[model samples]
Target: MTRIIQLSDPHIVPEGTLCYGVVDTGKALQQAVATINRNLPLWGKVDMVIVTGDITDFGTAEEYARFRSIMADLALPVRVVPGNHDLRENMRTAFQDQDWMPESGGINWSAEFSDFGLICLDTLVEGHHHGELQPDALAFLSDTLKNLGSKPVVVGMHHPPFNTGIIPMDINNLRDSAELSKIIESHPAEVRLVCGHVHRSVTRSFGKAIGLIAPGTSHTVTIDQRVENPHTLSLEPGAFMMHEWRDDGIVSHIIAGNYSDERHPFTTPV
Candidate 1:
């Protein structure tokens, strides 16, 4: 069985600084890393760790360095895509050594496993909060999916193609996704779309495929559904996702960043 860990929206800031003058994102990510490493024995072998996006809060060199420093302790291989908060050039320079980092153009790539394939696309539009897939990226997705040939696959991106009733975030969703939807609908096998940006776990149907949005590693976008409510962030417990390839299909589990106590077994009548 192949398993992949998804860590999203860490939003790392420079040392000694707190994100939005509240959440200690650095510490939050540390806890998340410790949590995953501590629980690895229970999950067995994890193939790779994928950080969907929003790695840094300000997309600075210092932030990227800090992000890497925190992630260094992870025991599994790592792959990443850029989010709105990420500066593509800075991210490219930071992960240039990694094979998945593209030397030029968008930070798009793919990985193939025996059971399924993983394709990560770049949806970052610099100097803007909203996301879009340019012509080149669309071409890449088209070619990659064509080559994968009808096996179950997970398409990872920074922006979700569907809305989650959060008006603030819904407005920034992947715009002009009609072509993207058409592409996925044409796939012969199951196609799962996994994304991050909203800082909350949301599931929705995107065309013929399932769309999943992961929670943040530090904070969450407040879940008020009222259209008039202003956008806000909450100090919610951090979490990550575990995507495993099961015999039937891929199963995703959300794991919290920390626990208050040790596990307890159920009591039985004597």
Candidate 2:
């Protein structure tokens, strides 16, 4: 069984600096790393950790360095795609030594696991908050899925192709996703779409694929569902996701960062 952990939207800033002068994103990410490492034994042999996006708030070299430093404590390997807040070239330079880092063009890559396949696509449109799967990324998805054959696959991107009720965030979602939907719908095997831009856990169906949006590692985007609500962030508890390849298909679970140490048997419930 292959299990993959998903952490998203840490928005790490430089050392001693807080994101948006409010969220201590770097520290929050440290806590998340510690939590995951502490619970690894219970989770059992996680294959890898995938950060959906927004590794740095300003996409600076110092911020990337700090993000790397915090993640170094994690007892697992990690892969990432680019989010709107991330500068593509900067991110590429930071992880250039990694095998998955593409030398040129969009940061599109794929990995083949024992039971399934994983594909990460870059949807970053520089200088823009919204996301778009450019022609190159679309082509990469098509070719990679064709090669994977009947294996169930998880596709990771920074932006959700579908809109959530949060109006501000919804407006910045992945644009022109019809082609993307068509590709996933045409695939023979199961295709699960995992994303991270909105900083909220949202599950929706896109064509035949199940789309899951992971919550952030630090602060969360406010949950107001009004059509004209103010864009904001909340100091909600952080969390990450674990996706395991079971006999039937992939099963995803949310692991909270903050929890009490005490445990009680289910039979002891009032």
Candidate 3:
């Protein structure tokens, strides 16, 4: 079994100010790092840790420095790809040592795991919140799957391929979704798509694949169940997801940034 953790949309900035006005993203991320190191085994035997992007709020050198400082002690094999707020050059400079992190123009890439396949897709357009995978990304998707033959695959990217009923946010972004959806739909039972950017845990079914939108580790966007204007962020606890791959199936747990309240049982003759 492979234990994989997904941290996304940290949006760490250079000056340590809240990326927006409401959340201290750096603090939240630091707490999460502590939580993982103290509890999650990903700090030791995690097969892979994938950061789905938006690592920096401004894509500055200092921002990456702050990010690195917060996650200094984590020694896991981590992989990262670009997001709307990330700059390829700056990321390359910051994480040069992590050869698994995709490099510029190497956007659409694939790597193998002990029992499955991982396809990292780049969905960032040069300067936009609305994201779309380019033609090259589509070709990469097709070719990568062809080579894998029958291994269960996971598609990783920063943007969710389909809008999640958030009209305001949806209207403003998440472009070219069907370009990749068609690919997944045709792949039979061989693929799953995981994405970040929604800042909330959401699940959707697309053809034969399950599409999962992981929560942000920095903060969460308000999930107005009514799905009205979706431009607001809430003080919701920071969170992330752990994908547990078992021999029979893969399950994802959306973990909120809080220690377990379930207490251990201890008994004594009193």
lDDT for 61 in candidate 2 is 89
Error of 2 at 224 (Å): 1.1
Per-residue lDDT for 86-155 in model 2, tens only? 9999999999989989999999999999888999999999999999999999999999999999999999
Q: Which stretches of candidate 1 lie above 4 Å from their native place?
A: none
In candidate 2 the C-alpha lDDT for residue 232 amounts to 92
Cα deviation of 222, candidate 1, in Å: 0.4
TM-score per candidate: 0.98, 0.97, 0.89
Q: Tell me the whole-model lDDT of each prediction, alpha carbons only.
A: 0.92, 0.91, 0.78
Off by over 4 Å in 3: 41-44, 101-103, 225-230, 260-262, 266-270
- Give the candidates in order of lDDT, highest first: 1, 2, 3
C-alpha RMSD of candidate 2: 1.3
Q: Between which residue pairs do clashes occur in model 3?
A: none
**Order by TM-score, highest first:** 1, 2, 3
**Ten residues in a row with the worst lDDT in model 3?**
38-47
Q: Which is the leading candidate under lDDT?
A: 1
lDDT of 1 by residue, 131-167 (tens): 9999988898888999999788999999998888999
* C-alpha lDDT of residue 20 in model 3: 81
